[model samples]
Target: MVSDLAAAIWMYTVGPWLDHSSKFTRTGTLGGHHLLLLIIALTGFLMLAALAVLTDNFTHSTPMLAIARNVACVISVIALTGLLALILMALLSRLLFGPLRP
Candidate 1:
């Protein structure tokens, strides 16, 4: 979860700068690239929150704790799946479009 948050922070902060530095033109005000980064960051935040809740409930052995853990697990899985999809998409794009040159 921490890692996810870190990655999200990096994407939200550094990713755009990296793109700009590469000399790629900005697609639009709210292009697919920007939207994708937002989605990834949102997912990462959700996963981090879920994990925090799960850990906070770890000391208890109540039904709510069980529920929290389950919910966290689901959120974490979803976040991981989204991240994996993005990675695969990146790989496919690289293969199809070839490497970005600047």
Candidate 2:
């Protein structure tokens, strides 16, 4: 997770910001890298949610624990669905934009 976050920051955030405003002419807009970073962040958040539920798995027995676990599962599913949708949107935009610029 830490590596993913670091890669996302480098590949998507700082890299693009430099390319956009660096010592050169530019016709920049928010592009796929930003979207991809968002997708990565969302994925990490969803993973954290899953880890929370998994950690709660062996809690012997408790009503509130079960409820919290179920809620986390549902929220994770929702996050997953949103992640898929974001991925599809990114793909479609890439298709429309053609190959990525150097």
Candidate 3:
């Protein structure tokens, strides 16, 4: 999670702001990096969700197993929702601010 957040910051916030504006004559917009960061962050979040689901095999009792599985199920739902939202944001950002062509 920390790594994902760092990647997000490095790609979107730091990279874009630090880019020399004068280079626009050579390079295009920096929004693509931000979008890529979002995708990576979302992937990490989804991976966490998968890991949570896979943790259900360590139960000591049926009741405890049920509770743990339930919690994992809920976490999975939230993670999937987060992944979907991230994908939507990436698509929208690209639509709104993709690179311009000559």
Assess candidate 3 and give its TM-score to the true structure: 0.31
Segments of candidate 1 deviating more than 4 angstroms: 14-60, 92-102
CA lDDT, every prediction?
0.55, 0.49, 0.48
lDDT digits (tens) for residues 6-99 of candidate 2: 4344445554663466332111112334445445555655565555566664455367656765664554454344335545766887999987
Among all candidates shown, the one with the greatest lDDT = 1
lDDT of 1 at 56: 70
TM-score of each: 0.42, 0.32, 0.31
Q: Count the backbone clashes (under 3 Å) in each candidate.
A: 0, 0, 0
For model 1, residues 1-102, the per-residue Cα lDDT tens digits are 665565466557655754465333232212325446556556756754655676673554467656755765565454445446556767888999997995
Ranking by TM-score: 1, 2, 3
Tens digit of per-residue lDDT, candidate 3, span 1-102: 444454444545544543444343112223324455455555665554454466553433366555755664454343334335545766777799896664
Question: Model 2, poorest ten-residue lDDT window?
Answer: 23-32
lDDT of 3 at 52: 49
